[model samples]
Target: MAEITVDLIKELRERTGIGMGDCKKALVAAGGDIETAITNLRKAGMASAVKKEGRATNEGQIGFFEAKDCIALVEVNAETDFVVKNDRFQQFLTHVAEQAADTKPESLEAFLKQSYAKEKGMTVDEYRASIVQTIGENIQVKRLSIFPKKANHSYGIYTHLGGKICVVVDLEGASDEEKLAKDIAMHVAAASPLYVNAEQVPESVIEHEKEIVKSQIAGKPENVKDKIISGKIQAYCKENCLVEQPYIRDDKLTVAQFVAAKGKEEGKNLKVVSFIRWDVGQ
Candidate 1:
């Protein structure tokens, strides 16, 4: 019979997040076999699985993968910052991103149901469950996206604060224009624009802002009130629209103007097609 050492008990406790005494007893019951002990703990529902499920997962790292004409971004979340730094969690996130890149699933539900190709006969959700059992935290795949290059298009990505924020941009331009795309992505990270252009701003949003601005200036003359509302709407668009916002690098120019100037310099018809930004837990 194998002797159950303290080190074995400690390892089990770390993996399962169970109490010290329970880990020791489980190890003893399994004759010091770590794998069997883990099984017993899980079967008996003494593992950290159920208790951790209801906890909010506000801490996580963004996983990313890029290939020729394709890119994927995934946000996998856990309950604590400590788990965010765990190597197993990081590895799992990387695998999730890679799977997104390969499969291009349309939605989060579909992505989880897809088989985890690296592991034999395991769905992504199953893999996620395995990770929860190992790390003893509520693990979730929050969101993911795949950006595949369209005809005559380019892509760029930027990850900030060690994946707390990520930006992906798609542009219609020459192949050598990836640097411009990357610069735009960085600007998106800083500016946090909600729409690509003034035209993309919804009519309802504009109406809502106008109502707020009108009420604030209602004491003024009727003619002046209209002008003030118009000005406020323009300012709102400038602040909220990506193309209308002032360039982060050069306040003298809007993002649209910056792209146009760069395009002229490179003799290309460059334009921003679309963009997506993700901030963890937002």
Candidate 2:
């Protein structure tokens, strides 16, 4: 390795879309040549089998795994959402997730440490590295969410556009309604609701919205603050609240109103406890 220069680091970042630190390190090992740096990183990711570790990988796949009482939905991102459809990466994700069902690793590190029988005796991390070389982008396990079903509650899962996104919802007060469950799951998939209700949204998020609203009203008179605050709260609720969001089927009414009407007509009690959405390109 040689002494890496700022220009070399900048050039490598531009060429490979990798982070500055990684680019410089690669360049140092490659005698400060941009092309050599790219080759070095590629080889490193190959032997280690994982490249571009933690570089805002917003691409990959939405994987689904369901067990007796537990349902898991994951969003694995690569550098580009286009790679979400890559056969190699998708297969790797499916294999890893299926293995995750039986292997109870407390954290991702532990999970990676659990070896795979089909992996030619490579650790999970090594497997990931090999897969990344084939895919040629920074890959990350962006989101991993598990929903457990209680005796009274039920689970539903849905994915769209070949794993472009995934949605999982917990429906409470089940009444032997498989179709309704699927419908709610698909609704979650298509609508991509942020939160089930206003109460579920974190206070920090609410405070952030309030700050944005406050800034918008900065030039307004002091007497107008209360009115601005009230309007801003309404806006915040509208954006974050699932019920306040317009139904994807028909924008005439919000999901809350739609659900209420349907529940009334069906003579069934149903409540959405929580919802999760993972958008592939987002």
Candidate 3:
């Protein structure tokens, strides 16, 4: 059998985040095979996976990556804010974002299993685990969003407060309006509209808003109540929908109006196709 050395124990400790003594014991028991040692530690319930599994990872950064054909956003969470600022953590976040943009996985689970772009033969989740070992915190790639580019459409991507908030907007009917799209993205960062238009707002949400409005005006006459409720629901859509909301730069014009005015100047019919906004830890 091969003799376990100090260097071997250190490597195991670095990979598993297990204590030095436990790693040494596992290495010895597995005859200096790192993979086998990891398995043994896990079977013994003494690995870092068990130790860090339950920690709340409420803090981290949202990373944004834009490719020629798609835009990707990834949220990586850690146990504390301090780790988010670590050089290793930031590098990991960037790599993961790029990986997401390249692979365009359909879901978070699929993204986690995709190969890490920076390192060959390593899955994204494995890379995350390596970072967790280095940083000594619970790290997770919480979510991923990918927006595929459409022909004759422009995309705007914005990151605010060092990526605590990231927004992406898709605009149709013009290909050269990147600045317009970016401005809309910035507005989204500020205004936080929930849907692109009133039509996009769900019926259930409108009904819920109506319920709240009706309860507030319960003493009004039944005939008056109908008119007030209809007006209030319209107002609610104006507040929550992107196209109907007042533009962040000019409150006098709705976002839809602002886009339409710009489109008229360019002799094109512009439209807000869709938008996505991600707030860290939410």
- In candidate 3, what are the lDDT values of residues 35-70, reduced to their tens digit? 999987666445755468569999889998899999
Q: Report per-prediction Cα RMSD to one decimal.
A: 8.5, 7.5, 6.5
TM-score of every prediction relative to native: 0.82, 0.68, 0.84
Q: Which 10-residue window in model 2 sums to the lowest lDDT?
A: 46-55
lDDT for model 3: 0.87
Q: What are the lDDT scores of the predictions, listed in order?
A: 0.87, 0.70, 0.87
lDDT of 1 by residue, 146-253 (tens): 888787787878899989999988888777777889999999999999999988998999999999998799789999999999999999989999999899999999
Better of 1 and 2 by TM-score: 1
- How many residue pairs collide in each prediction? 0, 5, 0
Candidate 3: where is the Cα deviation over 4 Å? 1-46
Q: Which stretches of candidate 1 lie over 4 Å from their true place?
A: 1-48
* Consecutive 10-residue window with the lowest summed lDDT within model 1: 44-53
Q: Which residue pairs in candidate 2 have backbone atoms (N, alpha carbon, C) closer than 3 angstroms, thus clashing?
A: 49-129, 49-130, 50-129, 59-77, 59-78
Ten contiguous residues minimizing lDDT sum, candidate 3: 41-50
